[model samples]
Target: MSEENTPTSKSTDINERHRVRMERKKEIVDDKIQQAQRKAGVIVITTGNGKGKSSSGFGMVIRAMGNDMKVGVVQFIKGAMSTGEEKFLHRFPDEVSIHAMGEGYTWNTQNRERDMEKAEAAWAKSKEYLSDPSIGLVLLDELNIALKYHYLDVHKVIADLQARPPMQHVVITGRGALPELIAVADTVTEMQEVKHAFKSGIGAQAGVEW
Candidate 1:
């Protein structure tokens, strides 16, 4: 080609450099986003004497639901009692699946057999939810205490959860979590009891303690 007809060398070099730099940056950003998505299927377990374990799990459920994700909740000990959160969530029952064991806690029930029965039923429901790939998140509320008290088989629970779909997430909450469960969990949070009005002779308040 004639020198006058050929493209300017300086402009051509600058354009090639800009294209290379943009391609490299795009590749790096794509890789980082893929890594973040791969690590998304995590299990969060919270156990301690303090409150908010179940509350925190339900908060995640609410967030997922808001994002148009399906969520399942199995309350092991808490009965079908009317709590503020439950009452509020009941409005959108289609987005959330709640299976509450009709019986209350062992401390309140005072019946070992009944408590075990309730826990077993709730565990069965949780197992079904864990197996469902459509469920983006499963909240097993008060499951740790059920495991601590030998209400459900911990090994079976772990096996079922580990076998779930790669993108599914799980959250277990309650006091006295087993070490084996913690070892398998991706994130663990311990809420220590620092102070409480209950010890000060104040009764449990609605929408706060319930």
Candidate 2:
């Protein structure tokens, strides 16, 4: 047909439209990037009754380590089993400090006094990490569980979290995160449990569920 109506011309027109759309998107995204000028560490909470909450926290720990930042981790209710993250990060002792302070899950431990004692001990360790300016990221693994069961005072936990160094990032992970905690955090992510393997016949898998 005519040169203007050729198949190649139609393809060229589509490409031009796509390029124009992307150009606008790039400008909008660049403007947003520019608007976010303030730089500081933030409190992040990953909560809800789903998997990957702690995994996501560990992912950020790895990210911090990749950036050459020192990381500290305290397991609140997960010392019953050796997690995959703990095993892997143990090799990088210089970069990541791990403290599995939990006495085990609450149901298994079945002692409120012991659980409270362990929670307090864990918080004591966490305060050290929070106070140290050298640690760039601190992960309080399953901390929400302890807070939920009133093993530790939520108000005090939040106060300590707030008192951390301005440049020290924190990640708290577990189900039933307190509303007070969420209110103070800079970022919050709730994992929705659509399905779980334990609900079926499958058991927790190493590297995948640990």
Candidate 3:
């Protein structure tokens, strides 16, 4: 072949190799995508003494909803009062179902009986959502704290959740997560407090906290 033809042939060979490599990469990606679609969802547990546990769970809810999955969230320690999460997530009322315990935190309530009652009510509602197959993701916000504070029966909660529909996803968040809860969870994340401004006497800013 002539010099010009030789260069053209080499360029064509390179292009062909690049095209084949891209095609193989695409097939690999397609196979992984199919695998993800076929596998069932699993439980997620987020627990720690640091802040934003619920926030992280809710962020996952948003991701699930974006994929057209139905999500339910039950706030045990956080009451019916307003928060930034409620404000934004409220926009997707149909896609998201949120049930807030009427009674707030233990210290906030200062009434053990009332707190227990509210936690029980919230647990009942959470149980109902957990059993529903249509609920692709369930966020049990502050559930660990409820268990730690003896606001709800931990065994009962575990039993009910253990009987949840297959393929359903559950996320429990709060400090002092129980061992049983951790055992059944497929993914557990502990948000350690490495350094936080709260220890420096800094008040929680709006939108960041609450």
Q: Is candidate 2 or candidate 3 better by lDDT?
A: 2
**Cα RMSD for predicted model 2:** 2.0
Query: lDDT for each of the candidates?
Result: 0.87, 0.93, 0.86
Query: Model 2: runs farther than 4 Å from truth?
Result: 1-14
Can you give the TM-score per candidate against the true fold? 0.80, 0.92, 0.80
Q: After superposition, how far is residue 59 of candidate 2 from its true place, in Å?
A: 0.5
On lDDT, the leading prediction is: 2
lDDT of 2 by residue, 1-210 (tens): 899899999999999999999999999999999999888889999998888999999999999999999999999988878778888999998999988875778888889899999999999999999999999999999999999999999999989988999999999999999999999999999999999888998987888887
lDDT of 2: 0.93
Worst 10 residues of 3 by lDDT: 35-44
In angstroms, the error of model 3 at 46 is 0.8
Off by over 4 Å in 1: 1-37
Q: Lowest-lDDT window of 10 residues in candidate 1?
A: 2-11
lDDT (10s digit) by residue, model 1, range 49-98: 99788889988988899889998888888865767777777788788888
Model 3 off-target regions past 4 Å?
1-38
